[model samples]
Target: MTRKVPLANYLFTRLRQLGVGAVHGVPGDYTLRALDYLQPAGLRWIGSCNELNAGYAADGYARVKGISALFTTYGVGELSAINAVMGSYAEFSPVVHIVGTAPRNAYTSRAMVHHSLGDGNLRIFADMYAKVTAAQANLIDVKTAPETIDQTLEQCMVQSRPVYIELPSDMVAAQVPEVRLSVPLNVSPPKNTDEAEDHVVSAVLSRIYASKKPYILVDGLVAPDGIVDEVSEFARITGFPTFALTFGGGIIRGDLENFHGVHAGKFGTLDFTSYTDTADLALLFGPLLSDTNTLGWSTVPKKEITISLRRTAIELGPSSHNLHIKSFMQKLITRLDSSRLSARKPTPSLSSPRDLIKNLPEIDPSAAIDQDTFYLRISSFFRAGDIVICANGTPLVGGRDFVLPVGARLINSSIFLSVGHMLPAAQGIALVQCELAESGHTPGRTIFFEGDGSFQASAQELSTIIRYRLDVTIFIINNEGYAYERHIHGMDEEYNDVAPWRYLEAPSFFGAPTNGSYKIELHDVKTWGELDKVIKNAGFQDGKGLKMVNVRMGRDDVSTNFKAALQLAGRQLMADAK
Candidate 1:
């Protein structure tokens, strides 16, 4: 006899199979019944404070665990999470967005639902999702539900982007063939033709062998494209000078002698840019060249001299070849003849962010912590395996300069540049780390650098973090408001200011245990000495549940790289005003 399971159970089971140990979302009337199936499917339910934060958390989880699921009710709930889903789409995070919609009869009768427009249009939300998600599935029939769910999830996994599944409330308990779960969904990319693979490999090798000065540029998409290991190996095998862009920071091992720090293009040091500009060939891996990621297009390598390996295609100079990036890279690595490849000596004189900090004048312990010196100084605090989350504004800009410890993963909004994303994202990332630790895997603490204004946007997620007792350390830069915005156009405008709060009281307010085994620690640091004390304290360094640090800086302070960019933006704004 063929086994049968509830439709919701089948869906949850599929997610669990794809490495989603927990589902993140707000429980609504439509999804409440389906939530009961989570435990049965061997999954945990993370009840987020709101749909947006849930979506953001799901995105974060996907970044760490490869794929994640988000459950939301119809119209209103899905709409609230659309922004985060879109960010996932743009940045290549695999998220399965399961939306619980009205019953089949309600859709047939065109019933005006409370969460929908009164005009009886219930399909509008799903239609909106179709634009942002890689694929969409509307499950109205139990007979086809199993296949639909598998195919939609496969799309999410293969494309590394969010996908939508509209599960009707009435169909939550509808019987579906459970036997289908025995056959794993095929999420792997189709194999490339031998001819095409050979041609691309030959073309890439020809350039590699001919060039005297070749460089490797690793971008953020390498991780999502599932080629980080291959790319890293290629860089290691070929003793070429390697550099990562802002978005690509921390993806590659930073400890390599050949690994120069992030290439900031026009904003970069003259010595580094001069060397990179003279390179005859560049092997660009997983290139995502959004303006912000590329420093307003300044950091983009010359296409004429670059070979770009993307998710689905390989760009050789002016032409693109249809090839699987992972397979292509694997084949290319196997065929590489190191004897023919040109080897360059490592340039040790180039100044990295670490070098900049070393060259700084002796610190005055009583001096207020400023943006220019903070990131460079704090770079020493990071350790291997740490998953660092930086917020959209100052953190993102300053964090690019971090000389991360080997194995540290930096999660920043590269293209979306969304505010309030990192805090909730920290909760999700930390949750995964906690799970890994429980499984006997060595996982580092989830460290987050957040701005006060960004923190206010999704602050309630802190309660979710505390409730789960996830291990996370948060450094809140208390600069009063949006310091990045202040640098752009408004220096002292009231509109840019955010209301002040007692940030150190967040853990207590969020319901973290005060005297129990899993306790929360808080620190307030305004000066360099205070920050050093907090960073060195044993309780703060090795705390269990949650630790919060409030580092206060000037409202107008901005990183050197960002200050130049923002000043140009301000000048442009002024010209437009004139």
Candidate 2:
């Protein structure tokens, strides 16, 4: 007496079971029928402007809500979204990319479909996706479809990476077993051997006891690996000073006494790297040491002094042990003796981001806003629990200097470095926030800091935001063109120039109403005083509806870190050319 369900029902229901509340995608002929099952499966369908934007939105949703789903038609749609999925893969976002592909007959007969290449092959896209995704499920057989979907989603959750599922149109309505839906997915990491765990624990504890000056370095992977709470507790329990990499800015609680500011390597103010270099024991959690994140790799501590914790392994100096991060953290926290550990005072030279910003020379209120003081001054406008999304380029550099309020999260492309991410991603994040708030969770504002060039890449998604009426505040850093590019190789090159739009008119052009029914406020700022006033306004802070602020700055003005990094890049390019 096995119950039967439509294949689409089983797929979408499994997604819902894994905590996916909404699905993001662009509709196409192949997926038109499959999209209908979303609502029946208790999932909200978000129609984004394009497949790429939909992928970005899904990535953002996954980062916040733990898991997200996206749909796209075969060939063209899937190809367009591959870049975003690759970005998700690079940054460890668990995104289930469900593709409505050509019917089974087309694949079997090798027939050409409208969306596919005129050639007979329909497997090319799925084959391409297999390179970037953790797993692939081509549901050609109805009998194995249920298990295939279950395992695909399980891989996504377990690896915290993207997975591809190619569902042929003909198979959407095919009957499948519903019995498999009752079994929950097992995403927990396999347990480590008792002896291995004990050995690693002993090594770590020995370092803690022997070291005179031990420090902790937090990174972005802590969030994906589900160890932020454990890391926070470990930091509190131990009196060691904690520092976050650029990607790890919001990972650590800013209010902790021993929580130092972001470690910017050589690009940071003098004295920041001194304490890190001199530390005898560095407990590095979830270390994603991209050159940009580590300030050209200048900030990564010496391997001899580092004990790196990863998702499935622990690296102690030159040696490594295969132990689950969660298990190791749990055992280490329980076994750690704070009373026996060394008591080291906070480093005098390493100051908090707030204190650093306060010490900067005050800019004239009437002067044009510059990158140096912009993000730091805007820090005053943030409150606890705010979610700030910083786009790549100037905003990424400046945002790292922001002194995030307690409980705030900074979402940025720290390693992926995608430019047009923050806008549509903000839409997805805001949507998830509203969905969760309905369930008694405290809602937070969705603040997006985007560059003008980056905004244009995915600007069409503004309509989706307006249609949903999400509380999203967008601040476009209008530096006229690609400022980051200008510093690297094209100082005044025509390729770096972006056409200037009447940036403030976005809301009206995107179908926003003039009447006060929906709060759509648009403002532009050039001077520091104007930016200050906009940040202090009641309507801006109310978090009612869509608000856009266009901030105009010079193309040459960039964060000190970015400028220095660009100079190094230019020199390297020159050396290569020679």
Candidate 3:
């Protein structure tokens, strides 16, 4: 039972105990051993194109599992990951980062390292994380390495924040002392007593009770920790409208009254923003109101009160709790009504699937694409058990606003906001859930709403899917350009206009198509007759192989989305001026 700690083995053990599903990064001289160590023990070692993409992929994984891993080489690798780590920290996802370091012997004696910062040089990247992560450990002593792993993981798990562990390649093989690695010891969340809880509670209830148009702000953490029901009932008891910041809180449940919708902020459905801006009081259940959640501080209602509980966080490590509204809603929410709230049936404007197709333009073979019109068609096809995975650019803007069903997860890289997020994310969720389905553990469908700009970045993993042969569908919104740039910066006579490719042909390139029926089809259904046939074909044939459908979107019809985003931004800015 006395296994001398190989640095990789110890770190791997620590990651698994902390619930890290996968460690993603392109390996370099510094990270080879850690990457090899992580895989054999059941944790996935996913190799992404660049370090930045790996960071985003880890963030995507954390979105579902609530914990993830970022493995990278030293210096540049660690630096690349900081933006992503900061993003997750802001949103409260637990991400474990293992940065490869100089091999113990060579690095120890070297006084001046090339990538080292000033002062004859030391690793400055570890210090950079001090503001964001709950803990950062730079271990030099082999004897104390075991304690290093325990302390760092403890902070990551309990606080639901990120933790960085720096490992010198020198230490990877260094014979270290043995230590016990087990499930984390029990720890209590910071508790509030009667006096502390009562005052905040009374203030919250009084605000919620008195306001005729009161509401609940359900952030990402509320539902994952199993608090959705209590907050859902709170909305019912007070008959308040509810919303989600980055989405989680039952905004899409459809059972609550006047469910105004999730706080899409600058990136959400247009109507929802108006409701959030005007609400008299906001009982923000457990949201951090991170930068991504706010869309670069694009908008916030000044009149409303914002409250967050112990579990529902308002402040992060070293961050301030900024709010004008009630900060005491969490204590009061537990005691509210639990009965099923009055329901509002969604009257779909695109009433029927036929109606949706009728409104949608036919997918063109030669014509360029855009994210807007494709979202219209894709939204129309969504089913009960299907979850949508949106990429950062056109795919997210094109699709995240679409109404999803209850129990249908909407996975996106909203926090990290990086490209290539959709492919790896869809791969991770699809692989996990497919395994679950095979074992009869769960039943659901996952569809990745990805774009060409993203897909091309990480499309090398296409073989992994066919080799595993998972049940999932990837809807490639092929505009052929970086579509987000197209939206923000117009394509008027600019090189933003990219050449088109036969994307459906990609599966063949991977060489491991599903059942050898790897399909490559361009979707072009101008009318219901063509569209229905296309959908029916995809529905029956998705699991048969790697199905790539080239959805020719509304590239030229950017007016609607352009206006949708800018108009909202403009009106809101004017309101803020007021």
Candidate 4:
């Protein structure tokens, strides 16, 4: 008995089938009716303060839960979230962006709308979205709406990037056959070719057997492309010295014997630099060759020595192959002869500067905290099964140095550099964590390393966290201003300074109880002793509800890499002035 369902139900039902537990967005005239179907389709509606925040939340959710959906009204709403969607495209986060559009009659008649620019061009929004998303679908016809919906969603999953779809306001209740609901959408990866797989595996294995010094360089793509388990297994099987780019922090479990931490070019530790730079063969998986990820492109292994595995192709030195990387990894894992692989050299402990700093003498209780000592000390607080997020400032640079336990996920923008993204993203992740816990799964805590400047940008979203009472812990690096920007261009400019707020009062200001079931703990730490005490506190250890820790540092305080970059920039500025 095939039932006729509304187009909105058909779309939301497909999203639910694809494992979308919640949808994040803001309501508008065009999308208000579409919002009504969310609950009926068995999806939770998380209304964000704005469209951009909703998009950021959706991106964060996607990173944790694999796929997420974000709804926005046409024109005004969609444009606001374009940056977030762009970030998703740049980083390969799978997000399905559905836009509630003007009715078909309005589009046919060129009717003027308030949200539009009044040029009678309703297609402009979809056109703009096409540039940022991997696929786009405009649903004006009832006959092909289901096919369009499934196709657009399949693109989002296949490419691990955003896909755009337009749902007209008046077409929400249009009749559509619900037969497709029983059949799951084909979101699987394309079938691997036997010839291509054999060639890629043979080439990679040949290089592995011939090389004297072989290394594995993991990048951020391991998560988006669904190959973390494969990569981990490969690393374990080969036991090769493994390193990561800055964006690849949490993907490789730090506890692994082969894991040697992130490779920061000349900026990395002596052993890290020696092993990576002197490698004869490098297996670079999911390489995102951004300047930030590669330490200004210095850490990128020589092209002749690097075998790159991309999403759709494989590149070995100068030669290239049209083979899927995920497929190549799967075949290589099964075919590789472990007995023939080179024996790994027993390397010394690759403790980061953070690790060494923790061994230093205890500082004065009244002494102010700095980047080097602060990040390492804070690393001790992170336990297993925690999702750590960092803002686009000192926290971004410093938090990457923290050692993550197995099962930890680190979310940081390598190239997007959106400052306020992590704050609202933490909110979305907290919501997802709550859902995972209710299903009898191992629930993880959402931990954020945010700057005061970044926190101010998305401060209103904290209210959403309190309303939902999601388990989130935020450590506000209250460094007084846009510390990252200062290191880049304006070192002492007034424009970089942010407005001062009582950072510790955020929970109460956002409507949390003073002392009740949803009890929010607050801490203001200015020294190492205070931070240590707070981390060891009973309330913080419980990790139940919202916990806020505000640590004050100098405005000029930044990581060593940031300091070096700042010095180079300063010299360049001086030369230009001359």
> Against the correct fold, how does model 1 do in TM-score?
0.97
Model 3: lDDT to the true structure: 0.60
* Candidate 3 lDDT, 1-578, residue by residue in tens: 56685777877876776566567777878878767777656677777656766666576667666678888877777787777677777667678888887765645465665556634445566678788888988767788887877878877766778888888876776676554665453433445456755655555555545664545666656633445556665656555555655545323464343454545554553445555566566565555455545555543445335544446343322333332122234555564433422222232321222334456666664444444454555565666666568777666554534655566667654455656656766665665565456568655666777767777767766655654565567777665576556544454646566557666666667665445454434453334355456666655444433555666555544325344564455466668879
Model 1, span 1-578: residue lDDT tens: 88899999999999988888999999899999999999999999999999999999999999999999999998889999999999999999999999998998888788987898988778888889999999999999888999999999999999999999998999999998889999999988889999989988998899999999888988999999998889888888886988888788887787777777788776653236777788788888888898888777777778899999899989887798988888888999999999997665666556566667678787789999998878878887888888988998888888877878878889887899788888888898998998898789988979999999999999999999889989889999999998888887888899899999999888778887867868788889999999988887777777367888999999888876568888887788899999
State which candidate, 3 or 4, has the greater TM-score: 4
lDDT of 2: 0.87
Native-to-model Cα distance after best TM-score fit, residue 85 in candidate 3, in Å: 3.7
Between the candidate structures 1 and 3, which one is better when assessed by lDDT?
Answer: 1
Worst 10 residues of 2 by lDDT: 265-274
Colliding pairs, model 4: none
TM-score of each: 0.97, 0.97, 0.78, 0.96
- Candidate 2 ranges beyond 4 A from true positions: 269-271, 360-363
Provide backbone clash counts, one per model. 0, 0, 11, 0
* Tens-digit per-residue lDDT, 207-239, candidate 4: 898888888899998888788989999998888
Cα-based lDDT at residue 304, candidate 4: 92
Please give the ranking of all candidate structures by TM-score, highest first, separated by commas.
1, 2, 4, 3
